[model samples]
Target: MTSATETETETETATDAASRPAPPLIYDGHCHVASTDFIPRQFMEDVAATVHRALEAQGAAPPLARLVDAYAAQHQDHDADALVAEMDAAGVARSVLMVPDFSLRMDCPLTPEEMARRHHEIRLRHPGRFWVFIGADPRHGADGIAAFEHAVTQYGFEGLKLYPPCGYSPSDERLFPYYEICAERGLPVFVHTGPTVRSLDYEPAHPMLIDRAAREFPGVEFILGHGAVTYFDVCADLALHRPNVHLDLGGFAGAALPDGWPTHLNRAFRLGLNHKMIFGTDWPLNRMTGGLTRLVREVTEGTEVFAGVRRREQALILSGNLARLLTRKGNE
Candidate 1:
């Protein structure tokens, strides 16, 4: 019943739509793209070879060499274009790039000025695909405040990345000014919570520390990274009760999934704490494919009636929640 001109138009529209890329499943909320100095070349090579062998051992088809080469590029140095290509291969759309500490001590080797420059360049390169988090060392005193301001004002970072108990403590009143500035700008602060190789004491891993900060800075949105690991229940409680608190399953959830991990995830979900969860892989520290596969399997296996809930929740935690949180006040 259609005319020849109408048929031709419809065909062109269908072809155009089909040419679009598939929507990404993963949006890594937290990751680090740092100088290779923090990670030796040999160590990265070993990890790549390990991934290669693991895939081969499973009888999985060999991945494209271009994919492997792109991922390996992340190891040598920070390249925004290479990272974007790797993300595409990994089915990740966006990643929040954070500075890395050589010793996992929260003290960065790069000066604030250098960090600002790099942040600007990365934003220029990737645009919406990459977001910046400013690293602040309270030990720098007034200089630290200046650096933080520069990162926000000049570099246009949306959040602050802190490793409390590594460089300072949540209870330290000296860091109040930094917190105040974040609250004023409505910047989110993601604090590293969970066991860290750098921590000699366990106090830093406690969820209670974040609880206090949430109470003190009601204006600032606080993200407790790694979900306080051994203190997941406590973190969940805080997230459920506090108006300004959320948690990210970065390394903790992935590391916990192999044995009886579904039980913990189910418990967290049943507690009505699903809205507070976000996805992260602690890149250069964890692999995206492995982490995502584990999450999908564990969540899907954990429920029967909630199968749809599981899928929706995974999508929310993996990307939607992050999009909402990051774009709360036009930071998107």
Candidate 2:
């Protein structure tokens, strides 16, 4: 294979259509602070090897320090100070932190409660720069609901992070109570819509189920995470037809790299879903610095595929849209 293309640094201030700087302040709408302890062992080894291979393919010997930093970043729960420091470097003003439900999939030491507690502590310490999405395995039943309520009422978590791959489904009757709580509290529910590796129940993480929840709870807002991964058309349909449903582009850009997820996002733009789309980096899995660049514009030239989208619309997707949701929810 030919050499991998060189990735451009983000110093260039001009774009193809206009001579403007990148958005001054971005809000990373989705992020995960789960430590390396959360990742399954074999997967860690696989990731390390993949990085080594990529470096080798580029005709450079992978430095041990590079591998060390890669492993360290993913292996440790992010520190609030460090996260904010990265934000300063990336020009990100705010970020939405998310915890994952590893109860069924990994041998994680921290229970959902402990994880949420840690995340809450960070949000409190960091204040305005960080918000949180509470995650749960509703399969834990009544106990899970109680913990969720406590997180919302006691700690003031702003959103719900549902991991259907953790032995549950978005359309399950058990989730209705949780969805109802979100509706009542003016919090949006974030559903993992699309395939997820490292879990047994990936098949049930569907966009259709999320759409059903959006339909059933019209008062509640549902944001499909990962842009429905491989279910772009379905996500676009739901976001277009259902005012309460939206999508966040988190892990998709990194997962699809190079050309990025243009076809899928371009479809959303063509259908006028800009206001419904939120920018996210799925941090650690993808870093805020470079990952965000590929998603918003061409790495080398800063050309965006959704050329017809106005600057204000792009700005909204970067931060304004999610800020609007947070504001509206606050008044509700």
C-alpha lDDT score of every prediction, in listed order: 0.68, 0.73
Candidate 2, 1-332: lDDT as tens digits: 33333223222322443565555458888887646644555445545666677788888857745775667665565455655766776678888987767676667666778887888778778878887888877688899999999998998888888877766778888889999898898888888877665434767787887767777999888888986345778887888899998888877665654456665555456667788888887776655346444443441134544567787887777788888877666721
| TM-score of every prediction relative to native | 0.73, 0.80
Query: Roughly what TM-score does model 2 have, to 2 decimal places?
Result: 0.80
| Top-TM-score candidate index | 2
Model 1, span 166-243: residue lDDT tens: 556764676778789888887888887766542234576576777777898898888888883457778888898998
